[model samples]
Target: MSDQHLLLLSILTPFAGAIGIVLLRQRPNLREAVTLLSATLVCIIVVTIFMRFDNAGLMAVDIAEPLPGLKIRFEIESLGMLFALVASMLWLITSIYAIGYMRQHKEKNQTRFYAMFAIAIGSTLGIAFAGNLITLFLWYELLTISTYPLVAHAGNKKARHGARTYLGILLGTSIGLLLLAILITYNVAGTLDFQQGGILAGKLDPAWSGLLYALFIFGIGKAAVMPFHRWLPAAMVAPTPVSALLHAVAVVKAGVFTVLKVTIYIFGTDFITSSGANDWLIWFAGATILLASLIAMIQDNLKMRLAYSTISQLSYIVLGALLATNTSLLGAALHISMHAFAKITLFFAAGAILVAAHKTDISDMGGLGRAMPITFGAFLIGSLSIIGLPPFGGMWSKWYLGMGMVETGQWLLLSVLLASSLLNIAYLLPIPARAFFGKAPDGTTHHRIKEAPPSCLVAMTITSLACVLLFFYPDPFYELAMDIGGTK
Candidate 1:
């Protein structure tokens, strides 16, 4: 197939799977088979595209021109390729994890859950390959709408409330702030196509750029830069697979991915640095990083704690983008993949706990690891990776980010990055630590508890191993990130 055909197919495959899922809803086995098939096809297609990609510049295909000079387009660039690869591959793994989770947990609306999950992956692929700001915005909104059903899958009061917050904040920010920013870009530049060095550099005055940049920053909302971040934690009432999707595979990744996209392609790193547009704004990312980490340290609910941890980890990318140095941009890009693997493994472990032992609060998890050794061991590897420790993927990203701070002499932000890692250790390490070493509550034995279903263990094992393998190899992703940072 032609690259353009493949590009279009990548987005359509998941939607096609969604249709098949709905049609086969009555046959649970058939419906799930469709889901897995679609996910596998997407992964294969994306890998093909990556294999054929030319890193010299972007390759684009215009799907439509909605208005004069405004087109819906798709493109493959280093960053987008990385994002697409991560989302597609993880979609397959998450599908495996979901089958185990939904079947064992006996979650309601299983067919609907599978269908919406497919659509959400489709929307995410659209966002990843978007060649212009308008195209990205369209897919961005579709992602929000498609995932709403999944977030509310439980159909309880808490689930409904979390879904509302998820929908409200995402829509409000995109319409109220993000759309405004796009309009301003179009008005100033006469086009919304993403360019390598930025179209806004000479056209928009540097003095007013900070105000416009703020619109893009807060407007994106999914980056979870505080005050706007409540939606993330609120959405934790969702099923664990959905939580994995939101944090690891799609939602939060899209937010930070767009932030990086705007930095490199929309704003241009040099333009941001020379104009000093992000000087004061960078602190918001810094604050979000520390404050979110601090809050994660306090949460007792396991999923809630991971949710807050996601909010903090996301800002690491935002901070990298705002810094605008090539190294910082590289770190931001690399983190997109590193964080995805590590965080998803953590959520998968959380789900495993819920399924096997019916535990939620950390206080109740003591000594449970003895019974469910594999699940807790996976969580330990994931936690160590998130803490940026050796023999894990996350270490590479944090190393580059810290190097970026040093290159720019941003000592304060460097301190923030270091401090956040400590907080990560404080909050994340303890879960696995307590599971293994701490006493079981009320001296209750957990011998009856067991590991999650085979499929769940399979998914977690793949991602957990990825954390270690990435540390040793960190290939294609490292190469792709360097391409964006212009360091290759």
Candidate 2:
């Protein structure tokens, strides 16, 4: 198939699968089969599209021109390709993990869960391939709407509250700030296309650029910069698979991806640097990084800690964007991929612990590693990666971020990076260490703990190994980042 056809297929496959899943509602096994099949097919299509991006140079296919000069389009560029590849590939992995998770946990409304999961993946692909601001906003809202059912899947009071927060913050930000920003850009530039340098360059007065920058940055709330981050932690009332989708695969990735996209494609790195429009935002991103990590250090629940950790890690990408240097932009893009693998592995292990030992709180999980050694081992690997240690994918992104800081002579931000790593170690490592060394909370001889089901183990193991493999074979992701950053 042509690249354009592949792009359309990558987006539509999951939507079609959602309908198919609903059709097979009464047939649980067959319904799951549809989910896995659709996910696998979408991954393959997205990989092919990435290959096309390299072979034929970046391509943009116009799907519709709804109004005069108002086009709805799909584009394949280095950054979009990378984001789409991450989302699609993880969709397949998450499907496998979810099957084991939903079955083992005995979740109700299984059909609805699978269908929404499919729709969410489709929306992510739409965001990934969006050619302009309007296209992206449409899919961005769709992503929020699609995942609402997943967040509220339990239909309980807590779940509904989470879903409301999820909707309120995301919709509120997009409509309130993002849409207004888009209108201001259109009024000034008259075009919303993702241009090479930026559409707003030399068009908007420098006096007002800072305000516009603020609108775009905060508008993309999935980046979870503080004050808009409450929804993320609240959404943890969702099942682990949905949590994996939010953190690793779709929602949060889309958030940071939009940040990078707007910074590079809408604001232009050079324009941002020349005007110093990003100066104040840089400090805000730094504060989000350190403060979120501090909060992560105190959470007793594993998922909540990871959620806070996600908020912290996301700020790293946001900080990289605000630095407005080539190296830092590269770091921001690489963090999207690196953090996805590492965070997903951590979440997968958290789910495995839940399924196997029925434990959620760190205080209750003493010596869990003794029984579920593999799960804890995977957790350790993920923790080390997130800490940005040697021989892990996370290290490389942080290295480039540090280089960007040095190049820009921002020593204070470098200190923020270092302190955040220390905090990462403080919160993440102790869990495994306690699991391996400390005693159970009951203070009695325990024998019930065991490894998670086969599927969960398989999924977590793959992502954990990916964390290590990325350190050695960082070429593909690095090349994509360099392409997006326009680096040598």
Which number leads on lDDT? 1
CA lDDT of every candidate: 0.93, 0.91
lDDT of 1 by residue, 291-348 (tens): 9999999999999999999999999999999999999989999999999999999999
Please report, as a residue range, the 10-residue window in candidate 2 with the lowest summed lDDT. Answer: 49-58
lDDT by residue for model 2 (179-296), tens? 9998898889889999889988899898788889989989888889887898899889899999987765589989999999999998898889887889898888999999999999
TM-scores for the candidates: 0.99, 0.99
Error (Å) of candidate 1 at residue 199 is 0.9
- Candidate 1 residue pairs that clash: none
TM-score attained by model 1: 0.99
The candidate that wins on TM-score is 1
